[model samples]
Target: MTSQTFGVQDLTLTSVSGSNVDSMTQLHDSYDLAGLTLPNRVVMAPMTRVRSNPEGLATASTATYYAQRASAGLIVSEGVHPHVEGQSNPLTPGLATDEQAASWVQVTDAVHNHGGRIFAQLMHGGRVGHPDNTGGLQPVGPSAVAAPGRGFTPKGPQDFPTPRALSGDEVVEHAASYGEAAARGIGAGFDGVELHGANGYLIAQFLSSNANLRTDSYGGSIENRVRFAVEATAGAVEKVGGHRVGIRLSPDSGIWGVEETESRELYLALLEQLSPLGLAYVHLEATTDDDTLLALRKAWDGTLIMNPARPGGPTPAGPEDARRWLDNGADLISFGRAFIANPDLVERLRDGLPLAEADPATFYAGGDRGYIDYPTYRA
Candidate 1:
């Protein structure tokens, strides 16, 4: 047994039984996610397909796409905005309306009937969007700062505008939106909901030092900055219960201009604040170092779903990456792009078969070409 340094807090990392075939077998084994029983430990991490219709409704292909990947222990659906104002880009789905929620029923039913548990990841883009992409509604964040990049729209890429700063009251409302979305997701037949508290979206903007320049209780110090994330998590737990709710966090990910000055201390404080809610799991992206990840894994009391690659990064998590993470204290491993090209990812890994590669061209806002046309190896 190797003694690992967690943090200055003296938390220790307990080594896994070992890696290699043992890890692979263990990963494919069934486990309990809160009250939900997952058939394997491979999680299909949320990847925005951007194929939603103008009304933010998911189509039949969406159902087929996810249903094909039903072999995953958990399938976290693409980022769905809680409201139109929170929409990050064009053609992304939403969980805000009754119609949108009803639209997801088909998707949830598809995955469930195939023996897969699915979770809706509620994401709000914050300052990282353009008005052209948001139906003329300006994106809102904790502050009025503009993100450093362009956003996708029907007219092609457009400049990201300085988002309208949410008033103090509006800030509170936005925080509650996650819980509201979680309720809609539950109503839509989802097994659970994972709050998108990562990747420089609404939650990340509030957690960012440079992005969130407000002096209110929602920003400034580490304690203050982590407040919105805590409230969002609490809201989800309030609506759907803690066992059905989880959150994805990127400790030091600087994506979309969100930089955590003290990634270690910030996330530890966040974990401490969220521990009381008793969420089903905390998904951590490999956007930071192993030491910080180990500390976060130690600090989080519930399940930890580890993504072996950085959020929105180029790399895809493979079996070897998953094995190493399992050795490093990750309960479940998430795969992003790997799951995109390989619907039968679990079967491939379990049988030691080849993993398929996804085409980057048809990744977003397209027909069924690259979306659902990926064939199983046996096919």
Candidate 2:
């Protein structure tokens, strides 16, 4: 692997990949999502890097880091915890503080100044969190069940913490937190907001029966389980408007011990419920097979953004993968690892250029050496 961050070598690789694309320029052209025009279809998917201030606020480093990738058509920021109990790790950032909200202002300004748009991804860790990470605050979830695997604590990996089962009033409290966080996101000057209802988080936990044993209005049947996500979306929409909000779902994914009995039935029902909301878009994980993804596309009437889960590689092959989604009814494609290696990925894809190899070691490390140092195509 080349130690050099960015240069002609990276561009050369992008050219190699670009040649496989059907139409480089057309692929690089702009598109619209929820009436917001994106300069191109290259979206930077939300990535977690345990970089935050001691108080869980977004620091200057976080702002600088995201600003470096402002060339993306749309940059979805890392999961920002809506509530204090939502904190999954000590390193995760939060939007609960005025300081954190204030710090994100620079990030928005940087991206906007560079002609890029951004959205904040709101996440509630639920059962995924540990009391050690949240100042001894009990992790809240739909039930008291613990996840199947170990979680990272400040010292090291520890058993999954037993979460406090939320009551009717607590559920409402969490929803209110989501609404307040969405408002904070807009206050931070984000172009829009994305609700992280995927990856076995709080919302997804509620949607899965294995995690939620509640018999109340918030649990049991698919409709009852999916109510939390629907309400969470409603909360965000109420704060930022439906047009400025998006929701991500991993219907078939069993991530972090979230077990859905009837995956298809539950997700389709959720989609049907969300259909009337007129959301900005529905982002599904790339793990969904072609058949399943196609079904979702048909069910959802709004913009569909698919994350192509590339095996053995962090980033998907841009043009070809994007074309696949486009052909399958996806209006946009989100790239996670690709944006890490190529800051000017859109330009490279447009020019039929090679992509720069990403350094996995620096993916979560706090430094400009890997974050902002990625080079763009010089020619």
| Each candidate structure's count of clashing pairs | 0, 7
Alpha carbon lDDT of each predicted model: 0.86, 0.80
Model 2, residue 229: distance off in Å is: 0.4
Poorest 10 consecutive residues of model 1 by lDDT? Answer: 1-10
Report the C-alpha displacement of residue 332, candidate 1, in angstroms: 0.4
Where in model 2 is the C-alpha error above 4 Å?
2-26, 310-317
Best by lDDT: 1
- Report the C-alpha lDDT of model 1 over 1-379, residue by residue, as the tens digit: 1111121112123345444443243677788888788888999999999898888998998999999999899999999998778888788889988899999999999998998889999998889887887778888989988889777888998778888999999988988888898999999999899899998999999889999999989989999999999998998999999999999998778888888888799999999999999899999998898888888888887899999886555656777677678777788999998899889888887777677777788888578999998888896
User: lDDT tens string, model 2, 49-112?
Assistant: 7777768777767776777777777899999898898988777888876777887888889888
- Which segments of candidate 1 are over 4 A away from where they belong? 1-25
Residue 89 of model 1, lDDT score: 73
